[model samples]
Target: MDVSDILAAQAEKHKAIAVEKEIPLDVDAGFLAVTDPNPIEKESYDENVEEYLQSTARDGVQVLLSALFSLPTTSSPDGPLAQLPPPTTTLPRAKPLPKPKPPTKWEKFARAKGIQKTRKDKKEWDEEKQEWVNRWGWKGKNKEEETQWLSEVPANADVDYDPTKKARDERKARVAKNERQHLQNLARAQASGAERKQRKADIDRTLATTRVSTASMGKYDKKLDGEKKLREVKRKFEPTEVSADVEKKNNLALLAKIGNVPAKRSKHEGNDAAINVRKAVRFASKGEGGVALARRAEGKAARGKAGRRK
Candidate 1:
């Protein structure tokens, strides 16, 4: 064959082979198409809710009526209508219930923020000593024992010295004694307020000039020095009787608001149902009874038959 004719024949053979290997896809069944134009009507939620409520009410009423009528009452020969004993009534509570405990962990967290129960259960207050004393444990016995290791050991005091050195040492001792005496006088003497201020200023200036440093790296901080005893003493004491007086007034007001309130049966929202009882009873008459109700009704029918035979 010619080259063009051969190429056309090869192409036809490849097309037949491709047809044999072709895969049929079910794309419409697998996924939503990009252009779906069908509109859906929204369901009415109010109608659904009403239907649900109606169904629930109808079912409950059916159950209740079935329970009431199917329960066997003891028949007396004296009367056809047997009177059921009334349910016992409960007495009204004189006092309200105690408040429930806190529900949230936040309340517990707040109470535990910095406070813990006092750890003074085993300790007692010694009013005479103005201190708390540990009562449950034996105290340590502190006996006075003199340590005598250095009693027989003598220090070297007699070194041969020059008279000039002795005189210099005596003069130095006298100067120190005079300086201590002057400081003691300054402490003991009562000074005017202005003099005290001047002395404090002089001391500060001297300390600044000398560049004196303290052993500790601590600085004066008011925050570190919390609520001290000085502040507690400064606070004025108010009598707590005013709170009791206010509580009494509140009690009186509450009593006045609730004047002559007669006791009544507890009111419930379900009692305000407007459904037809006749329809519910009709539905219930068609419905099957529970095992207990069926047995009770059978027993009642059997009893009636025996009484009729007698």
Candidate 2:
């Protein structure tokens, strides 16, 4: 048997790998995804649903695989690796974009004046030290005036005036002023938008509560002519229009729970004697009560002796 015919048939079978349709399949090799936009063939789909679906799916996969193989590959230890380009498809964000932070007073002023922001270098060249030193950190160039041995004193300087102390104080004042401005900016940011409204509402509620918390509960207090009456919140309860059977079942369940609870014991129930010890004590003491029985017993002998002598 000649195998040339079998080889030719196999080549013909593999020749038509390219799928054709009115709308081309969208293939993203980077994302390894294929989208088929062609309308389904009604006759083929109606004749055999599973076969038609499988052929459609196979065509899409064939196209995707062909695209993948066309990409340039690099040699690797395991095999040749194809480097995928950036994905063309854009995906939606998982979460909403964050709100912009409120700007500070300085930022607003700078924007209004059309001033561009410029970053300062962290390190500056020191001519005396012949090296680059930090601008504002430990042993930085900014502290040179305070750390220097000699300083220029003003003509009106006081007797106790020290140049080093003055320079240090000025530096500290600048740091304090920067910190204060930072705090002010933070306060301004927090006091903006919905948060500010919430804070104001809380304050109003607190004030209303305080107004009613007085000697007479604000009942006898003088009220303004245009003042609105405060409406107290009412308690919520289950509706009376519920099904009778459901209500009956609920009532029975409640009764069952109440029945399961143990009853409260009497004060003398703790005593386990055959007779009622508390009642006997009360009778023996002539209704002076069980607690006073000991005191009565202590005075009984003295009373008996006094009666006999009489």
Candidate 3:
């Protein structure tokens, strides 16, 4: 039976059982068919689809025209709607606002004193003291304490360098280098415009790469990323086909095709097969160039041997 007929039969069966049991439905879900009191009028019918498409096309065209017409003209510098400025009046360009300086204690005091600009710190020769005096920072405890701090240690004295002195110095140098690098990285991150984006991308690429281990430099770890995988030592397959097996006159041509050629120096030197291979070479001058020349020489040598034997 068709799906609708089957569904109707099932519904009738369910209705008959319900009536026999005198079953009363509790909710709308119990009913097979749902009734819509007032559904939204959707333009989904076959007859309305064409009209909907035409209406949409008209709306899209209007929107496109409105967008095109809304664009600002090159001739006008005014705000939206391309309004002109007052006649003969110059419009002053708005300058960029300067970054506000941080409020330091000295700067705050100077500002309180109504000073617009502060003098830069500089060393000057003091005429009264007959020495150069610093214009900024503490001079320290009356020069003698400073002299003691700056003085070199007496070599012959009981004082000696600590065991950790060298290590401390190295660590300090490393920290300084790291701090400078950190500053450079911070500058790149804080920078404005396209260069910052490129710098960030480069940083991300570096970070995405596998971290190399300090131990063995990945020499021991076979499974490490970016490390070369282990491969089995391959067997050497040479052209070892016998000349008698092929119809071709040239053994070298057979060797080229089959790739079964044997090495000249083999462990089985005293074997009968090796002896036969050596004997075969005397007649192998079958086809071209170097092989033909060598074969011709061998043939001549063999004929000479035959004449000597007689």
Candidate 4:
């Protein structure tokens, strides 16, 4: 029997995978993005939602895999690895671009005069040392005159005048000037109407504090012109000749306010009995109170004597 028909059937069964759609799938291997632009068939989707979705996803994945395999690959120990090209798709930035900083006075001046800023080399060539030495910092060329064995002094300079000290002082002055200018620029940049008003208020408050910080608390100090009168805090007290009834009420209110005094409940309050239980108890104990009655019932009359002996 001929097996050509069976072989042909088997060949048709196991063929290369191919997915066809109205629109092609856009695959960005660089970003690992696979977008399916083809519209879903309503009849197929309505028949089975889950299967339709899975089929659409499978087709997209198959297209992405095919695109990936088509790319050139480099051989490695493990296997061949394909290098993805730069992505063509332009994605939006997650965060907005940062705002430019406010220009400093020097920067503004440079821009105005069309002066291009240039960076100076940190290292400089030394003729004597025959090597590149730092222009500044850590035994730099700027400090060479101060550290040198011999230094030339001015002809008219005093006998006590030191050339090394002079050079060091000049360098320090330049550093101090630069720092002062930096602070000035910062202050200028940060200055505003609101800031000026706040600064003025701060100055006034400081001045007021200083005025009261004198030996006599500014009482004996001579007042300056245009100085506002400081507000004096006066303490008021109740009259010594207050009515007895009013004073008693005031004392009771103060005691209540401090939680020192408890409310006096009515005789029937919290007691369902017709007779006042408290009064009956007091009468039965002969004004000695419940403590005396309890001691008498417990037969502890000799408690005081025992306690005293102990």
Candidate 5:
């Protein structure tokens, strides 16, 4: 059945039981009396009646069950009640937060000056010392102020004030600064060495390339010189005299065909004989002793042939 139907049936049964017993069912008062160990009395009956009703309305079936199964209460002054174990449930493991780094000298100074303090209604500056003064008189104000306070011995101060902590902080800062400079110098030396090595490598590569190029050019120049020498030797040893004789004969044959000469002259005839023949031909053509010159030439030829036969 539906929950509401079940609840209604149960209420009806309770009402019927109450009626059958002929007892007034002060449900709220009964619930409250069962729940509360020490119930307060009301002045008016109506007010008490309203309180009991409210208690019953606030609880429901839970109140009825507790009332029905309640054990008899007995006071024992010697011992406490037995405690129930807490409920167990699965839970995630929480990661631990990182520990905060120790504050530096500057940070400590700022904190002492109350620069890191939370803002509040009362904030005042001491004009004479140019510092902030807290009304609460908290220890951290500034290094100078803290020092001043430390100088003045207080009767009830628990913690001892010493300048050793500040001295140690200064020493740490100096050491850190020196270490940083040393590392920077080491890095600079390494970088300079690397640059020098690269430059040397580049120069070597250029020199090697130039050497190879020069060698190749030299080989080409040697090949050209050899070819030029061969050409020169061939020209110097060529048959120049035979060629010149053949050229001269060709020129003479061309001149004879053009009728610029009377006949083929003796190969032994000198320049003076050729010049006299030219002058005799010029005198014969002009009809001056031309027949006499022809007769003299025939006589001289006959005498030369007779001498050669003898």
Candidate 6:
């Protein structure tokens, strides 16, 4: 082989080797390849980048940087800046409140004048109606107009007042008084009823006692009269046609039955002796020859007695 053929052939072999290795031979192409691979190279390059950032911050150099070098670059007309948007600001709005209603005419009058209109004492003026009125007098109302009719007389008129209302009140008071009196009367009647009941009870008790006493006294008197009658009957009648011995025995039994002698025994004996003498005189009179026959009998009796003595 000649020297030219050997050099050309060696150059062609080197070209083929570059093509097989996929390595560009152009300087600009190589620069692009190096720059393009920088992001892959920077996968562990944060340590060095942090040191560089700290140095740049100390030197007061503002710079724009991205973690991925392949990312698109940002433009700044002012200077190198941090990769961030500006802060948003907003102002607060104020809300309005509702207003209160105005005061009424009457309320305003009350507040300003310090006086209130009343039914008993009317006010001098009506602000809404705009009219004058009596301060302390009656004011009639027009029913059709629905407004007060002022008096023709002066503001203060003294009308003749009727005390009939006062009289009516007095009448009511009297009625109440009468009611009170009626209640009192009822109370007294109740008390009187109780008293009457008590009196009736007392009368019944007295009548019961009187009846018992009268009955007892009447029984005692009747018993005494019966005893007197039995004694009189025994004295007035005696057994007739009895012998002297039997009579004497009967008299002794009657005396024993009569119990004790009387306190005036002498007077009783005297009357008994007198009654016997009277009975003997009546027997002599009843005999045939009155007093003469009695004398002859006495003479004969004397002679017989003399002969017996001799």
Which lDDT tens digits does candidate 6 get at residues 206-235?
754554476564345434332322211245
TM-score for each predicted model, relative to the true structure? 0.15, 0.54, 0.16, 0.51, 0.14, 0.13
Q: In order, what lDDT does every prediction score?
A: 0.50, 0.88, 0.53, 0.86, 0.56, 0.51
In model 5, the Cα lDDT at residue 36 comes to 33
CA shift of 198, model 5, Å: 2.2
lDDT (tens digit, per residue) of candidate 1 on 240-268? 66698788887899987875343342222
lDDT of 2 by residue, 1-310 (tens): 8999999989888876868778989999889999998988999999999999999999889999999999999999999999997888899999999988888999999999998999999999999999999999888888999998788889999999999998899999999999999999998888777977998999989978977999998898899898778768989988989899999999999989886434554343765569987778778889898668888777898899999999
lDDT tens string, model 5, 1-310?
4699889999997864332212323333232332333333455445688876565444444454444445344446964333322323334659877866545444567888877655664445768668777543353333333345355545765586455455447656867997887676666555656777898989876754554476564345434332322211244554656787787888899987886634454444436343677566767656556677778889999999999999
Tens digits of lDDT, candidate 3, 159-219: 5654245444665686798788767655654664587789998976554343344376545
Compared with the true structure, model 3 gives a TM-score of 0.16
Number of the top TM-score candidate: 2
Q: Model 6, poorest ten-residue lDDT window? A: 29-38
Give the Cα RMSD of candidate 5.
42.9
How far residue 277's Cα lies from its native spot in candidate 3, in Å, is 99
In model 4, pairs of residues that clash are none
Query: Taking the tens digit of each residue's C-alpha lDDT, what string does model 4 give over 1-310?
Result: 9999999888776543587778878999888789998777999999999999998888888888888899999999999999998997899999999976668889999999999989999999999999999999997999998998988788999989998999999999999999999998888767844878899999988988888998899999898898898766789999999999999999999987975533454423655468977888899899999988887867765876788899
Ten-residue segment with the worst summed lDDT in candidate 2? Answer: 259-268
Model 2, stretches more than 4 Å misplaced? 1-7, 112-116, 119-134, 137-140, 146-169, 206-310
User: Which candidate do you rate higher for lDDT, 2 or 6?
Assistant: 2
